[model samples]
Target: MGLNEAPLLFNFEVESSENFTFIPMSVRFNLDRFGLRITLAQWQMLPLEDRKLLARFPVDDDTEIEPNFDHALFEMLRTHANVEPEWFTPEEAPLWRRTDSVPEGVTHQAGLAGLTAPSVARWAELDPFKRYVLAKLSRKPEANHDFVPAMKEFGGGA
Candidate 1:
């Protein structure tokens, strides 16, 4: 499924072009959009250049770039990183893709973080990638640290 394209990286993530310890939100968004999954370790096994490609690839109807991210990414993962791709079951509507409602997990994390949750109207205003970051961060306790930072960066008076 083609999704709203997102930036290759976000300011909230603790990333470096050198090590890239965490997978950027853009890669995660594209992976979910394309239904392919790779673990952090598998990502680490990839060469820096290959990881950069995953971050920057269009994975959409950009005729010049590879239209299928899953296929090309798995090829690189299998060949260069020797990692098998895992597939996530598709949801009827992924949280990030829906603009009509705010996700509960995100609300929960925001509450715990002592931050107000983004409103339905505000949530709808954000791009899917920002929604993806919020939804993903909120569900993962270890990742909750990024929730407020992401909200602040997304900037609806957060």
Candidate 2:
């Protein structure tokens, strides 16, 4: 198969699929984990089908049937966008995968959004991608906040 199925997305990210304007967290998570650096301009340079292919590829443990997802992305960008893939090492120990404690940024962002932060047990219950979404959403200051929607979608909020 040339492409995998569409990876699961947070509700907020689904809107971007209409034009592929913003990168989906599913793709972003994998990019960060795999050390691939795809810029907004670089993403826009690729054809929609290539963008969709990147979005569809899975990075989970269940992805054994697929060719290496990052390699596919790199090749697509190189072939279609005519751009060399930039690389950066991602975190050796990402904070999102921690279950013992909720990150300060997550709690702070949730508090600012007026949402209850996930408790340690609740945090531990999340799949890695969900945890990854929360951590990424909360790690930075942004005018458009998705942390609340993500928290609610993830059942960390009412």
Candidate 3:
């Protein structure tokens, strides 16, 4: 497969130093991205140092990370971590089609109003990509406020 056709997450490094470990994360497999879920429990078993390092890794707005493990490591993580494997191959779709960029203004007052302080605080902890998605998801056809509400939902307020 070509670069675009190949799974980008396949290049992720699960381990670099012997001591660093990862928390188990459970995710549904996506054939398009070649992703599989690992439970948080399995991640907790990793060496604390490794877990700490992975924490610095960037997760996209969709809570997705790129340059993940290759097929070999996918199997290894599943086997060793005891994570069940579910395989999928994404059907061909235009990679450039944007679904989440719904202009610059969107209202998320409904979503934000229902959230707790801690939940809102945790939302702020997310990276920009996550913030972007929140803004996109909460946008309406005729939003009054700028994407501010979604930004606050993800912990970004001005």
| Highest-scoring model, lDDT | 2
- On TM-score, the leading prediction is 2
**Candidate 2 colliding pairs, count:** 0
Decreasing TM-score order of the candidates? 2, 1, 3
Candidate 1's TM-score reads 0.81
lDDT of 2: 0.76
lDDT tens string, model 2, 69-105? Answer: 7787878788877887678977877888899999888
User: Which digits, one per residue and each the tens of the lDDT, describe model 3 over residues 44-79?
Assistant: 554454344343433332223444433433555555
Model 3 whole-model lDDT (C-alpha atoms) = 0.37
For residues 1-158, what per-residue lDDT tens digits would candidate 1 score against the true structure? Answer: 34335436777775432357778776876677766788888888888777776777653423335556677688888898777888877565767668888898888888787788899999999876678778878776543666777889999435
**Overall lDDT per candidate, in order of appearance:** 0.73, 0.76, 0.37
